[model samples]
Target: MASNNRQNSKMTDDGANVTSTPSHDTRQASSSIHVNNLSYDATEEQLYSSFCVCGDIKSVRIITDRLTGNSRGFAFVEFKNTTAVSDAIKLDGMRINGRPVKITVAQPRNSINDNRVVQNREEYQRNTPSRTRVVHCKKSQYDVYIGRPEYWGNPFVIGKDGDRSDVIRKYRAWIMKKPEMLERAKTELRGKVLACWCKPEACHGDVLAEIADND
Candidate 1:
């Protein structure tokens, strides 16, 4: 929240002393906002233009697959202040490219780092042979659901069979359509030590944590 110091003035060639206002450091004032359920074809320009109506954007970063280089159906928009953050929050449940995008303030980088440590620990605990295995449902984008589908275990089959990518895409689309389901998942998962397969970068588990903790 700290800003750059404003400097006192100096006399110019015109013999007038001017006091320069402190410049807003978008980086220092910057806060990240998460945007999910983006259309695969959504462009950075479109995102920038939409959010800029609320505040000056520091940057727009869209997450993409490492190998395929395709949009992961999400992005992080950085804004200059809490006011902009509030403005952007109004965009949540609003349509973007014919689909409603889920918007929330991203967790602090340090908190996310701390989560990695906890996630890894929980992941290890869940994988232990002694613990009872829970159902594996790929129903939501967050991987929270009741029934385990057969495709999940054997996602890579031949001829006409769908792969993991297909499953993820379908799940993302499904959850985006029914955000109530996501809220339900967050409510159910709150306060429990759940495993997070995705770490370091943002993940659905983190989203659930953010929602639950805030509530």
Candidate 2:
């Protein structure tokens, strides 16, 4: 057996710290119990049959390995009433197949990433500015400023007379420029438009007029 770590603690067969009941406000009307310390040889049907003594059973599942299809040594048994779940926990550590069992209320499965992945993703998004854009420079220049052509003078107009090396350097800086306006423009365009085109009219006059009117 592999030694257990915090990340894989819930995978254990000992239900001691493996399972917990839902909060008073969230407890379901149905009674769902987690059974641990199950015999690797025990089948799902056997587990359902064993727990049926407490009350009517709704479902049973013996969790198994995905790759090998072998039992993970734990199972979930659901009863028709919440009272059954309470009663089952009292029978915790009861013997089954010559081995003691651990029983408790079953909890919902945490997603694969859970809190750790969420925190990391949030931190990354926070540290990095969302509006930054990367553009390649056509010319070489160390210093460059990025602004809209309508608002800021055309960069190409100034670089046109410079030496080839200087022009290349300036274009490179333009490519690397990160501007707030560019970020805003990207945000405005994102997901707003779909890849689509209007059907063309066989003739130019009325069809063009109709298209313009529709716009």
Candidate 3:
């Protein structure tokens, strides 16, 4: 009878232990989250400090532009406790550094196929004709056409009656070879006809012609 009672007690302890494991798993899963819509000037320390109000922060990462090393305006913060994640989201759009910040749980990174689809969609939007304008090349002697964004559309024909197609092809090649030039042109022509142009669409041909003639 003594041996039987000991065996029954051991079985009861095993059942209790089994029931507690899932609760521990739930606690582990709730801790981390993703944050977004960060200010361009935000630093990791600032982010972590801001989030600490909710709970203990395990880590914080702010994504930045690779070339310029500037903030990409987003970040991810992980909490040591799951309850802190909920509190952090409640603080979403909370002001930090004089700018509103967006915070949310981080989704798992997409697979390669998903990334390819996103890239293709962005490329399609960028290449659409209505969205871009053709500009006559002013930099070269030939009748080269450049494509600019519609907002910055300022197409110009450097020489009289230049072939629009040839200009477009040349501009496309130039953009591929020297992509930085496009950004420079945008900055140079800001708040005016040239800055808003999308290359190769000639959306601002007349305005560009006047500007060139004035020059």
Candidate 4:
């Protein structure tokens, strides 16, 4: 119930605690809204064009399927202030890509799969105005980035199948193995920001945050 605890404390409807991230507290969540019933064909540009009339939008996040990389029929839209939230809500029945969408205030994530990175690093997104806003992996176009999926351990098989988490898992499974690599990671991440990447959306950086976050 403490402030940090509440900000950091997220739980599922069943009451299980899971890793939550930057989407809410990381940005002006008060001005953000959740969008549902999206057409898979909807583009960020289309959503922005639709909602821009309400007010200046901070960002628009369209949820996507990680493995297959397709739209998941939902997204988050953030404006410069809460007033736009009200205006945006009025457009709930508006269509994008020919689908009438449903709109509502955004909610905090309380599931493992709904993961993201923490922003403790100083230089990660330092110059960005909305640096607190988390980013999307594919959207950001990064070859290797930190995020929530890394923390949740979603069966990353390697060479045989998976790769990222698979390598991280094997790191622990063997460190029982390390380059000192584990120690180096800890040292490098010290005194930095936490999950500043794609919020509410899971990322591999989540695992990095957890690892360096611990003793």
**Candidate structures ordered by TM-score, highest first:** 3, 1, 4, 2
Error of 1 at 108 (Å): 1.3
- As for lDDT, the candidate ahead, 1 or 2, is 1
Please write out the lDDT profile of model 2 over residues 1-215, one tens digit for every residue: 75343232354665555533343465335468888898888887787767888889989888975433557789999888877887788889987776789997886545665778889978976785433222223332212223234332224433464754454355445523534433333343232211111112111112112222220
Q: Stretches of candidate 2 above 4 Å error?
A: 1-30, 108-215
Q: Which structure among the candidates has the greatest TM-score? A: 3
Location of the lowest summed lDDT over 10 successive residues in candidate 2: 193-202
* Model 4 weakest lDDT span, ten residues long: 128-137
lDDT of each structure? 0.62, 0.55, 0.56, 0.63
Candidate 1: list runs displaced more than 4 Å.
Answer: 1-30, 111-215
Per-residue lDDT for 1-215 in model 3, tens only? 23322222223644652222222222224466666677787788888788899998888888864433557788778787778888888987888787887777775454777899989978975775332223435533323232443433323343553566555445444443443544444344423333323334443443333323221
1 against 2, candidate with superior TM-score: 1
Q: Identify the superior model by lDDT, candidate 1 or candidate 4.
A: 4
How many clashing pairs per prediction, in order?
A: 0, 10, 27, 27
In model 2, the Cα lDDT at residue 211 comes to 20
Listed in order, each prediction's TM-score against the native is: 0.41, 0.39, 0.42, 0.39
Please give me the total number of clashing residue pairs in predicted model 4.
Answer: 27
The regions of model 3 sitting more than 4 angstroms off are 1-30, 110-215
